[model samples]
Target: MASSVTKEISYEELKALVGKSQNLLLVDVRTKDEVDKGRISGSVNIPVDSVEAAFAMEPEAFKAKYGVTKPPLDAPELVFHCQMGKRGGTATNTACKLGYVNARNYAGAYKEWCEKEGK
Candidate 1:
């Protein structure tokens, strides 16, 4: 399925980015418990419920609210994912509306990640 966001990153691309970039902001939009099961390495949890508050706060406040540093308005990339794809897509759209043009969704999401790991 086509992602609503223009910059949808595939699982392969995301895996490469995780290894290559330390500054990339990877967010898991699943619930806390879903995340507790496991999340992509380097991804911070941002449960879809709190997306607005995370993006709308001041830099310092954003960091405290979401437990991740606020990427600059022109940040290069902010990647999001959920267990499947829906909530991550919602996050990508919300981030764009909040002026984070760099936000991208991991189209394959965490379900794909787990499946691949079991292979």
Candidate 2:
């Protein structure tokens, strides 16, 4: 299914989902430089620039490359985040453009995460 819009998740909702949802895939869209400083504990770095490439990868290849299960194009609850809302929003738009119907952006990104969850 082609997605016309990107979904959104609040910091509190995302935090709760992280605690409770094993099926969640939290992707960090920040660059490697930003990630080198620190990142959320369970987030896998996809870097926004490479989102299309990641999605284009074959199922096994996507898993091998990203270290996470590759959900189908119409999969539910695939989320993206970055240092702030901007990159994450862009990445989510990119994912949706690539036909990832459930692509979601965590608007209150790493900065907000730090405010709520700390270093």
All candidates: CA RMSD (Å): 1.9, 3.1
* Worst ten in a row by lDDT for model 1: 1-10
Residue-level lDDT of model 1, residues 58-77, one tens digit each, is 98988777677999877887
Q: State the lDDT of candidate 2 residue by residue for 2-104, as single tens digits.
A: 2447679998788887857877889999999999998988889998889889888899999888888897887767889999788898889988888888889
**Candidate achieving the largest lDDT:** 2
List lDDT for all candidates, in order.
0.85, 0.86
Q: Write down the TM-score for model 2.
A: 0.90
The regions of model 2 sitting more than 4 angstroms off are 1-4
> Ten residues in a row with the worst lDDT in model 2?
1-10
Supply candidate 2's per-residue lDDT for 112: 92
Return the top candidate by TM-score.
2
* TM-score of every candidate: 0.90, 0.90
